[model samples]
Structures are given as C-alpha cells and as structure tokens.
Target: MYAGTAKFPVRKGKNYLLRIVNAAVYNHLFFMVASHNLTVVAVDTSYTKPYITDILVLSSGQIADVLLTANQAKAKYYMAAKVYTTHSEANIDNTTTTAILSYVGSKSSTTPILPEYNDTATVTNFREASDVAILQAYHFHIDDVYTTDFPSNPPIEYNYNGDVDKTLWVPISGTRVKVNEYNATVQVVFEGTNIFQADKPSNAYSRL
Candidate 1:
C-alpha cells in the first residue's frame, strides 16, 4: 500500500535514461509521466529501435529502458505506476504508486491522468488472443508490447468459434507450460490455440 514515494528532481533541457523494471510479485504496471512522453530505448536487456509512446505496460520480470527529456515547462509532474489487471475475475488495485517529477525551481505539481485500473474487456480480449497488437504480430513481429523477429505465419487463415466447439474451448485444469531455449526463435500462442491444426474446425476452437 505504498501509494507514493519521494520526489525525483530534474532540470529543464536535460535528458535522463531510466531503467524501469517491473519486479512486482503479482502485478503488471502501466507507467506514465504527467505531460511527458517517453521514448522507449530498450526492453528486457535488449536494445530496441527507439520507439516513442505515452503509456507503457510491463509484466513482472520485464524491464524497459526509456529516455526522458526535461523539455516541458518548469513545474512538477507526477510519474506514476498503476496496476494493469489480468484474469477476468472481479479483482483490482485501485491505488497507484506515484513519485514526483519535480523540475528544479518549479512550484506547482500536476497529477497525471492515470489509466483505469483494469478494463476487464480489454484484458479479456488480450487473454482471448484477439488484440490487434497480438493478432497483427502473429505474422512477423510481437505479441503485445514486445518485438520479436519473424516466423512464418499459420500459412492459412483459420477460424475457431467457441460457441460451436465446447470441447476445444478451454485448457484443462492443470496448466502445462512449454519451455523454450535461451534466445530461441519461436512464436507461442498461450490461449490454448493451434490454428494450424487441420482437424475439424469444431475441434480447433480455443479460448482463454
């Protein structure tokens, strides 16, 4: 329940490199700074082509390196991390972990507009494997937020309608994980899906 921490000072026109690590035990974070945009420089120990984005989402064990330039007006801003929910259960942390980004010689502080704690629909969609970022990356890129090199696509567009295929809709109780080698090149779909299976479509439906 540590809602906020000490103030971090900055000066106008200076740039800072930050290592943002998500080491939480059971939470994911959506981090942002009030009135500031982050230029993402790296992820999980690998240097990525710099990408600029406003809100960043990171799961436990993930690390993001971002460049922050103090180019805004000389004032104080809130840099905050709030929980991003997983599972479609009725649970969440409505509190935020915040720290002040105070510009030297500034007098006022403005809190950032934090994102909603957990939009179950979006989270469920992400879990459902239908998010645009995830679906689009099925061909040559990433899952959501992380970038990956290419692997051939499913070779054909396959459909899975859970409404008709009850047996194929969910994973059995015990979760079996597949391990990959270090730096292995493979694409994994964790929603119990294998769209490449050429069996009856009724046996191909999967859901999270």
Candidate 2:
C-alpha cells in the first residue's frame, strides 16, 4: 500500500538536490531512488562530508539533503520509502509511499525496489511519540497525565538480542521524568529493547 504520489521532472545529465524528511511519528524508513545513487550532503540542517549511498535509513524527524544526478536512461523512476523494523514480531504497517522522478519528455515509469520489512542485515544503522504531551503534563504538574513509575532497570532480565519471551515484549506505559540539577552535565544512554514501539520514544529526535 502507498500514499500520495508526487512527481519531479528533471533533465538528463543535470544534478538536483532532494531534501528528504522522515516526518512519521513512529516509523523508521528506508528511502531510495530507482537505479540512482544519492550523495548525502547535509543532515539535520548541518553540512556533512559527501557520502554516496543507494539507500538511506531515516528515523523519525530526520532531515537529509542529497544530490541526485540524472544520468540514467531517459525514463521515469519511482522514488519510494518503506517501513523498516528490527524486531520480527513487531506489528507495523508494511507499506510503501512513492514519488516520481521523471526525466524530461519521458512518459514511462519504472517501479523502484524497496527493502524488505525485516531486512536487518541490510540496515546496519537506525520517532516521534507522545513526548510533547508528556512534557506539557510535567510542566503543569498534572499528575494524571502521566505516571512517574517508569522502570530504571528491566523488570525481568533475559537475552536481549536472542529469542525474547513474549511476556516481556510489551511493557507497562508511563511518563517517567528525571529532575536534574541546574548546569549539570548529563549523559543519556539509550538501550535498545528490541521492541519497535518501545524504542521509538528514545530515537524521536534523531539525525540520519
């Protein structure tokens, strides 16, 4: 399944900058242009060393500027984004969204190949969740909005990367807040829980 279609008309042998943003609230997406290698130039509004890649792994709210050279055959190609998940049992929408990259005077379009949902070996690297509403509750001291009982340690320890028990797959939800001293240096270490819904909150404001 897919959403709206957007078309981009380009001239052959010319370069174009594609600013891609992953705005999904809780989806880690893999984006690509058919038969094209995109050179990533900037990430999160900061310029970076040029890195050419065939596929980009975008977490929620990530912004990437890539340079695309229209040097392939003069035909339209599909630019697509699809969901990527690490956990095998995680329930997610296995669908793709697409746009068109059409060459000047080209009429035919080719379907782009997207990565599989559980293509863990292909994704070596890694959204938004209810953080904003939780923050508002904290600022207003609204105790009912969220609870402070978020666990600091695992309730039951088990093999993290190996086969996990189904009981530990879903955890109790709460808005846990930590109060820090003024001007204190803080270091946050995010642990991967191997659950897609549980991991999204930690990676909400990530860069590509």
- The candidate that achieves the highest TM-score relative to the unseen native structure: 2
Candidates in order have lDDT scores of 0.67, 0.75
CA displacement after TM-score superposition, residue 196 of candidate 1 (Å): 52
Top candidate when judged by lDDT against the true structure: 2
> What TM-score, to 2 decimals, does candidate 1 have?
0.56
lDDT of 1 by residue, 120-178 (tens): 55445433332234334555555344434333344234254223244544543321223
lDDT digits (tens) for residues 1-208 of candidate 2: 2236788899999999999999999988899999999987778988654667788888799888999999999888999999988766357888788889989998777887887887876676421111225667678775554566655565677765546678877765444655555666655545677654334223233222
What ranges in model 2 sit over 4 Å off?
1-4, 125-208
TM-score of each: 0.56, 0.57
Which parts of model 1 have CA positions greater than 4 angstroms off?
1-4, 86-90, 120-208
Give the worst 10-residue stretch by lDDT in candidate 2: 199-208
